[model samples]
Target: MSRDDRQARRGYHHGNLKQALVDATLELVVERGPQGFTMAEAARKAGVSAGAPYRHFKGREEIIEEAARQGFEMFADLMEHAYASAPPSALARFEATGRAYLAFARKFPGHYITMFESGLPIAQNSDLKRTTDRAFAVLTRAAEELIARMPKDKRPPASMVSNHIWAMSHGVVELFSRGQPGTKTPFAPEDLLESGIGIYLRGLGLIERDD
Candidate 1:
């Protein structure tokens, strides 16, 4: 077989080549930052010829987008379950959704990295955008419920409230969950997130501060 024929053979090497490419992309995103690796390297990692990846993905961007898309889907599911399964209180369910974010990131570092750090513009991919919106909507819904208890004059915009918590959770994940994890600290990431949210809510008078 000519070299091109061998490359073609690699394209047909598996029944699930697309998933293999996605898996390889995830691995590479963690090992080397998303921009650090090339599609050829991903194909090599997946044990396929350089040309084989094109059969499954247009380029590295598509592979990362797929990883991010899957990540958002899983994230939305976890957040939905958390929001649904918590104690029967808006605060409880809202807090549960916050916890779920941490759990998902800790459990799926590769997906986490790909989804948030890959720098791929998810909004361009309709499916990826929808999944991401789903994940975010969980937080937005929780924020809406939590803020509804306050007077309309005092209530923060739901999007701002949700984005605030989202930023806080992301900060905790990056600093404690992913970055500077080995550094000595008195608090775990969960504690930090919980306390951070508590403080923010208290400042907004959304929650009564303990005397």
Candidate 2:
């Protein structure tokens, strides 16, 4: 091989190896479910020798786990920004965080699937668990702020409120936002989520009729 071609090839192998593998894994994940593809395929897609990936990742599972870890960090940042960008009203901030959840799922479908559907438990990795908790905490923080508006005697546990709303938001994303073609819902996911939160708040007597 010519010296210039060899130089270029060397750069390809060494340049940002981990990120290239991660990006390749994400593409494969979108094209095929997490378990559907092999490590060799990931190397091929990343344009490296089949053995190149082992320098950065032990196996496909590690690649997917890394993707999930990054996804949660990005998810937490988006939710934090959404919570801050809204008006100070507790309801508005709470709703903003919920919308952010849907937005992340739609924009990062591969990450979403790997993070939630790949059957990798976040608790297995301390860093992954911390990242996941940060993302979930944004929702719980919003819930606590919103629920605080209620009379203390009538307030529900913030964890309960957050978990319920998280479950509702997750359902909307999976059924509607995740590009599921056959599943039909008459209402847009945003409408469904906002109105559902409203109803839940009203049911708890946390939402006053006047405003």
Candidate 3:
């Protein structure tokens, strides 16, 4: 190959090497907190020379931010899948989406924590912001559908109903992630979430309210 071609290939390799390094560092973040993570360790895990990460990332924080971006991208994908996989009914889809979100947080606590942290530079990424909104948009559509299906006599405004359901589900999942309805309690996480959503539906009069 020509010298210029070889140089371009080397640059591309360096870019990919840095991405792999950040990916490895995120895995470590799951096991070890961010404060305890290091660039050299990430390089070792990525199978690159110890100094290679410096070619792309300035420091440990830079790698963490990139990893956080990747995490949000995955989060958006999970939300999309949950919404797409639910049954025909809007309410059924809403519940499924809520459960899926909680499952994601429980399964990937590290990424969940990073993605939601306001101080993280990853939150500023345009793609992360866009993906985050797309995920919420899925929830919004489910809310609109549910509101549409409500009995003509009692249906709430779509905007109001959407906001209510979204808030209700997000609150339950966020609290559960913080360890609410602890294992010491009789109810499983799923049980608590199901019960909470039922109560919310009853309040909205979407389900028959027992007097």
Candidate 4:
């Protein structure tokens, strides 16, 4: 066996080696993009021998994939909590979820980037797929609730509305929240998202009634 493999086999007995590798991988992901580094580099950064990471991850891709998976899990939890704690109004709950989405991106920039921009093969990772789907389901559920309250003839399809809201929220985060160059908005990202959603609802003829 290669010397690196021997070192990795030794590392398997270290109680915290797996977590150490994961932490090191996260640091690397932030400094370099997810695809920027290798498993050996992560092991070295973690203060372990080059082969140490092999005990925890099959390869560098698995390391990045796990990071992305954890990120999605956190994202889904944040959305769920936002929805659950929101005011009784459907609109309020929906708006709260949007705000939570933006807050998550801001609070955990590294996780957010990996979760959305890592370019990991989510289709091949059931855990990642499930976590991502859970996060998205929050938005879709909120949309369904809102549409259910409208007159059937006046309601837009829940799936389409959900997609529109998700697109708008993501756009606001990328363009305004992240401070990307070009068209600067006077409004804060949160306000912009709120106002944009309001306008969209109004355009759909879904007027908000004072509760």
Candidate 5:
């Protein structure tokens, strides 16, 4: 068969081709935009036969979706660690976890970008969505505790408060990761998240006097 014909077929050459293809595609996605990437190119990058990706990914969309899935899993693991190491208070855990979230984004810029691809069919991938939601739930739970302690008159719902804080951290991290160095905006990523969250806590009227 011609190289083009061989490339168009759906089947990989050997064991581990799936992982190899995924790895190659991730590098490609970082190098190239996610939309234009081709599975055949991933196979070539992996040093596998042109058709190798088919053994694992049904199509380019599947490859992209799975790559995104991997990103969410990495994020969830980091949040799990942050939640465990945080001090015994909702505010403490929220701050620490926000730091962890920023650290993860800074350290894994490629993976972090992939996780929030609204274009990808995340709803179809329930398991991956569930894992991502679990991480978000950690943040929401902390917000809920703070909200509950409020005198009801001044309290916002946990989900609303969590969304505000999450948007703050996520926007800052994303802008910083895009190489916006020290823009000195009112809310610098680090200061804004840690301190901004503290401000939110105070407004919520939930003070945990710690040593």
Candidate 6:
């Protein structure tokens, strides 16, 4: 066994050490963006020795990457719950998912930024790719349901619609919801998303009467 493993075994709270390290990493990400600290710093923050993080993570990159993975998993759950709680209308459900996306970004700024802005190569990280795909699948499923309710001739391709909505929602969050520097819009992020999506759907002849 490695020396780090030996030390971990000797520790009183070995079982919870991984979670403690993750928690500490998140605190650091919040204080100083995702790239702000080193693995040793995260270990120190977690109250472990300099070499302790290696017991759970390969290095600093892996630590943040794992955090991003967890973020995506939580994000998927939020989207699923939002869709499930919405009214019967497909449009309503789709809107709810969009709102959930924005809400997640607002509530979990550290996770949101790391998930999107961390610059991690998703293709190289199987776990990250899988979790991200699951989160995206929620949006795609919602789009498919919405398109199904439309007239056969009016329905756009589900994939195209899903991508469009995802792009718009992401743009809105990146520009307005996160309080980032961008065009100063008087409308709230949710309001902006609602209005923009409403217009886009109308333009596509997807919905006529706004119920």
- Each model's lDDT comes to 0.87, 0.86, 0.71, 0.82, 0.73, 0.83
Q: Rank by TM-score, descending? A: 1, 2, 6, 4, 5, 3
Residue 182 local lDDT, model 1 = 51
Sort by lDDT, best first: what order?
Answer: 1, 2, 6, 4, 5, 3
TM-score-wise, the better of 5 and 6 is: 6
**Is 3 or 5 the stronger prediction by lDDT?**
5
The superposed Cα distance between candidate 2 and the true structure at residue 152, in angstroms, equals 3.3
TM-score of each: 0.91, 0.90, 0.72, 0.83, 0.80, 0.85
Q: How well does candidate 2 match the true structure, expressed as C-alpha RMSD?
A: 3.3
Better of 1 and 6 by TM-score: 1
**In candidate 6, how many Å is residue 125 off?**
2.3
Clashing pairs in 6: none
Which portions of model 1 show Cα errors greater than 4 Å? 1-14, 179-184
Q: Model 3: per-residue lDDT, tens digit, 1-211?
A: 7544454455456567767776677677767777766777877667665676788889887777776777777877887798888887777888887787778778776676666642575346786677677777777777777777578788766667556655665565566555545745565667777787788888876777767
Given candidate 3, what's the lDDT at residue 112? Answer: 67
The candidate that achieves the highest lDDT relative to the unseen native structure: 1
Off by over 4 Å in 5: 1-15, 180-188, 202-211
Candidate 4 per-residue C-alpha lDDT over 2-99 given as tens digits, one digit per residue, 9 for 90 to 100? 66666565555566887777777878877887888888888876666885677768898787777788889899999999999999988888888889
Model 5 score (lDDT):
0.73
How many steric overlaps are in each model, in order? Answer: 0, 0, 0, 0, 1, 0
C-alpha RMSD values across all candidates: 2.3, 3.3, 6.2, 4.2, 4.3, 4.2
Clashing pairs in 5: 12-52
How many times do residue backbones clash in model 5? 1
Report the poorest 10 consecutive residues by lDDT, candidate 2: 2-11
Q: Tell me how far the alpha carbon of residue 25 in candidate 2 is from the true structure, in angstroms, after superposition.
A: 1.0
lDDT tens digits, residues 1-211, model 2? 7544454366386578688778888888988889999988887777776777898889999999999999999999999999989999989999999999899988998898889889997887998999999988988999999888788888888989999999999998877775654368767899999999989888987776545
lDDT, model 2, position 7: 42
Position 97, candidate 2: lDDT: 92
Report how far off residue 169 is in candidate 4 (Å): 1.7
